[model samples]
Target: MADLRDVAMDSKAWPFQEARALAKRYEKAPPEKGHVLFETGYGPSGLPHIGTFGEVLRTTMIRRAFELISDIPTRLICFSDDLDGMRKVPDNVPDQAMLRENLQRPLTSVPDPFGEFESFGHHNNAMLRRFLDTFGFEYEFISATEFYASGRFDETLREAARKYDDVMKIMLASLREERQQTYSCFLPIHPETGRVLYVPMKEVNAEDGTITFDDEDGREWTLPVTGGHVKLQWKPDFGARWAALGVDFEMYGKDHSTNTPIYDGICEVLGGRAPHHFTYELFLDETGQKISKSKGNGLTIDEWLTYASTESLSYFMYQKPKTAKRLHFDVIPKAVDEYHQQIRGFKGQEPVQQLANPAWHIHGGQVPESDLVVPFSMLLNLASVAGAEDKATLWGFIRRYAPDATPKSHPGLDAAVGHAVRYYNDRVKPHKTYRMPDVSERAAMEEVLAALDEWQGEADAEALQNMLYAIGKEHRFDPLRHWFQALYEVLLGASEGPRFGGFIALYGIEETKALIVKALRGDLAHEEPIDI
Candidate 1:
């Protein structure tokens, strides 16, 4: 997808405007092809909080929107600052490093050793990836370890800081209040071994590719810069990193911003002017407490995918940034359905909003058509397939409707189609069938069944919704939902299925009636939930 700069002349709106202004001030004039913008977030060293996605998701969307409106390239850089030492205990981390002595430097951080991932850092970072990847987000993931060890940015860091000493000092001093170390400048410390991490200054004079970095501590021995780590302090090192890497945009939670007054000011100095943008706000819990990795109270992005799609997550990110709200997993499916419906309303997708400020337009505002998903096409096509009844019928429809949703030739296509079909059913025409044990529901359900039984040639969508709704109301059921569930259980031998009208329309009314009776008679428990 394109970056922000391509569309700087397009328009000045809330997000694009803010991004543009920063781009210009930084002297990073937006490009026609655009420059790469880096967006970063950390992996939860223990359990990841929604905040990880909260931060990255917004940045990703802006990048997408930018590409949408222009022709620039957009990229995200997620820095899992996992090398920093473990700070607090988590339920998952029984042996958390509690002592400040045990708390390694920010550049070398992590969780407990016996964690799920290979390293504590790896575990937490992986969780972050799970969340981002669930949404199919693309980013250049860099580890603090790899950044330091690789030495790709080593000369850059020394150069940026050395060249901009006065500005760097100003940024450092600005962070004094929230600043933890009284030492304005501190040396990088190894996370695992807890000692100064350094390269041989004695060897620096050589023009040849020669370098050495090791600590006196036993395990801190130097390895050939097969390049695995980056050695930089938190203060100016961070600023230097940003400047060196050309990170045009990234966001932090309000807590970090509220606590670290110098962030905006510091980023300004790093880029020689100001950052492209910063959107800040608090957190929201699905049911209660704020998400916390330390307390083991946070639900990770991986957890989110257990229920919702990436687009739904992206849509969640599209909501107002300043306001904090809980993302209950229960609403995700409906949100997806609604989002798909919204796409239909737009006749496709939301047009990309361009970056208005010429200065910071580093990339365009629209996602590549490849990355942009047409939710409506996916849903409607799946419906046609599921309605067609036979396997061949469904396959033909799926191949036509959501060509990219799945591969028709792939072995997994059926399962993928099944998922799409289920998504559609739950979202649009949710219905459940129940076994008629006692005659009242049985009689009414049968009456309703008989009505469909007696007559029904062509499927009328609106008419079916009304008819089923009327039957439920007349039978004193909770609208159509309750009875639908029962009907679903009876017909599909499950708690629910697609809307009755939609299902009947697809599979034929008579077939639905037969399935319902067969289910009530205990003949179809063997049936698995499937598109009607």
Candidate 2:
């Protein structure tokens, strides 16, 4: 354990790097709170999106890394800013007319369109909790509405009121001239209409812990900032929440990067130290547009889970967090296969390398051994060629290639087999385009067929790969990869595939020969011209 800790102190992995900085914060002494607080904030105006998962999962990774090098304990808080008003209705939810009526109301006051929870905020919070629970995340859920209403933030609210002008000076500089005139750090909720009023504050009485504001209806009211009568504006809330929680570390998307100073300044003004921040690049959709929670344009947590394992999603989250990544169906198979690949490689890696492996951080150091011998891409290709509608059909070939393995013995592989079949049918089958082999390609196919028929011993993948490599050279193909591409296009109806020899070994020698014969006969080719 001491040696592992020594290695972690010098590790270059991002989580360890972030954790080391946090550990340095308390080098002189422990925090007054006794344990460091790590926080990830969520706005509950919309359902929990993939961004929420990335933030929490990545924070947890750092927390796990911190435990390895430091003796101080840590707590993770998944804070939901549900008290914020719903400025606009989300397009993805049901019952739009009902939501339209609730604009400018705190999300907790808006009725749930799903009719399951007390309000829209509660519904979204429940969804977030459920999603986190699905991944076994250890976190304490805190609702802004509950925190404010229960007076847990009373001291911070009072502090903000006392430091109102100071907070305004920090915020006003960042806003446009037009917005600077009417903006106040406090937004008062209307006493009668139950709506959050956005009007300018006429007076901020710090001594009384209250603010004077006029509603849109032109009635003046004085409301205490405590007990949920008023809440801080979004920008102020960001820093105030940090101050109120004494958060040791927090992470947000790049969209919030510009506001870091405002949040930090406000925290300092309120007599609380600013937390360490890590801002990751936001995720993009297939077209490179930023993903939105309201627009629901990109993939969802449930959608990814339906096609792949949860660990693969975590693996995706762990990679190059500062770089923007396209979160779509195309990336899933690679994530799945690569995650298992890491697991397979863990046993052979040196201890330092293992500490740097993503699989270690993902599984919280107890990295599981991978039982999935067949790669996910290979399974998808096999599924495409076999027209597999069920796991049983894929298992038929899996049994032939690996005689002793079964669904019970290889649970990970079994789940991957099921995922492959679903991914192939839904994502692969619809767009598949097969074409006739050109004259030279047809000659290569006949040669491959004759070589398969003449083979006598067991189907050895390496030997077969060598034979195919020789075949590609014999055909005078400029790049040897073109021969493999021709084989994939003609036989699998896709431009990419697993290693041809490995595919043949898994699918059986006779089966591949039959497929080649079909391709040469134009039975597998579509009537349409190949688009190359």
Candidate 3:
């Protein structure tokens, strides 16, 4: 076992630093049975979304970090709060009428809208598992329904029941005046109706860990805490789960930050210590509105993977999770590019520095040594300019630029090219507006074309970039500001684009001259030049 102090002092990775702190905390007071448990929670009310993936992915990264510094047995439990009642039908699911009929019933008991699984919760749980499995996440999945029904929560339930009054006080203090009138920490499942009822317990016997509550029909019933007849409200449930599982660490969104103290208090009252808590800012839509599962308004896991690699998505989550970030289609290209940049940066770094690189955490310390043949954004531009749809056409340009490269050797680039072509056709091409270069711009582009045509030797992106800058300065176009814009306007019809030097080199000098000739001839011209 590595000395945690030595490990802490050895690495600069934030995840490792957090791991060291957790290790020290655990050493001060080890958990029961000498195991460290990390937990990530999900609500099976709807299909697993990108936010769900983010929580688990981030937790898994922390878990990986902990393993590097400690020899203690570690476990990551991906728990689904499936026992929760279905308060309302999800907007994205089918068979709305059937779901509406099952409202207020435990999600595990509600009929599956898709009719594939036994219940709504089961269907969603399966979807969640499938999504996680797609990314090859390493964790054990525990369903709340099974955990509660199988008596895994028996001890915790009894403790919660014994601390019922204390828990009530903690919950009611946080609720509004109107809500306190009917609020109870324990909600009993009606024996007959099977619906989870929110009415206050009519009588409580702490000694026996049992409660008496009336159903909606006014029939009084008594149930023991050992059975799955009662469940704690969400806030209490959060605390109870921490105590039950002996969780050492967990992370949730910022929306739950305010309730964290209350949950910690509830855990303390229940004779358990609070786990380490991390609250990340919420993911917002492109419009800067909160992305909600019920509203179904943001990019989903499937939607992201459809156009980008899983590593790219992981990299997106790896960045400053505590700060709010926008997750939308528009951000995908940048994420892809950043992922490549990290991969490239990882290759040249020393061992200690590489350990601290984001790619180290992003790939769980197995950073791949591979060259980025082309940036994804560059591929998008290449696809747009050349009208390339398949890998053959894209690879044609790649081979021309780098004769040593092949589609077989650069699978990442190949796959990205396919996605870029589809993305360009679907998202970028429709609203694309090409701007015609004015007279001065035309003369400058012609000069660039003539220079490229006369050049015979190999021209790298740096040389080409320098030449473009010199041309811009010679033509009084201000190379620092507007030189790239002229090339973009004439070639790709956008104000901004990939580095023109790299794009020109990758697209080949002959193709570049031809594109310039077309632009000068007004064949690719727009109605008017767009002002920057």
* Best candidate (score: lDDT): 2
TM-score of model 3 (CA atoms): 0.94
Could you arrange the candidates by TM-score from highest to lowest?
2, 3, 1
Decreasing lDDT order of the candidates: 2, 3, 1
Candidate 2: segments with Cα more than 4 A from true spot: 527-532
What value of lDDT does candidate 3 attain over all alpha carbons?
Answer: 0.83
Q: Show the lowest summed lDDT stretch of 10 residues, model 1.
A: 354-363
**Mind giving the per-residue lDDT tens digits that candidate 1 earns over 1-532?**
3332344345544555544444454354554325757667574445677777767766765665455554457778888766554544456555544423455444234433655655566766776776667656678888877776677666654443343445435555555554523332324354466544532222221233223334544333322222333344455555655665666676776666642435444555545333455757665566666677676554556555544555555556555667776665445545555544444344242333223221122122332222213232233333532443333545554444346644434433453344455543544334323344455567666777777877655556557767888888888886657777776555543454455665555455655577557655665544434445
The alpha-carbon deviation from the true structure for residue 137 of candidate 1, after best TM-score superposition, in angstroms, is 4.6
Residue-wise C-alpha lDDT for candidate 3, range 396-428, written one tens digit per residue: 888878788876887777778778878877778
Please identify which of the two predictions, 1 or 3, would achieve the higher lDDT against the true structure: 3
Worst lDDT run of 10 residues, candidate 2, spans 523-532
Question: Any idea what lDDT model 2 has?
Answer: 0.92
Better of 1 and 3 by TM-score: 3
* 1 against 2, candidate with superior TM-score: 2
Q: Give one clash count per candidate, in the order shown.
A: 58, 0, 0
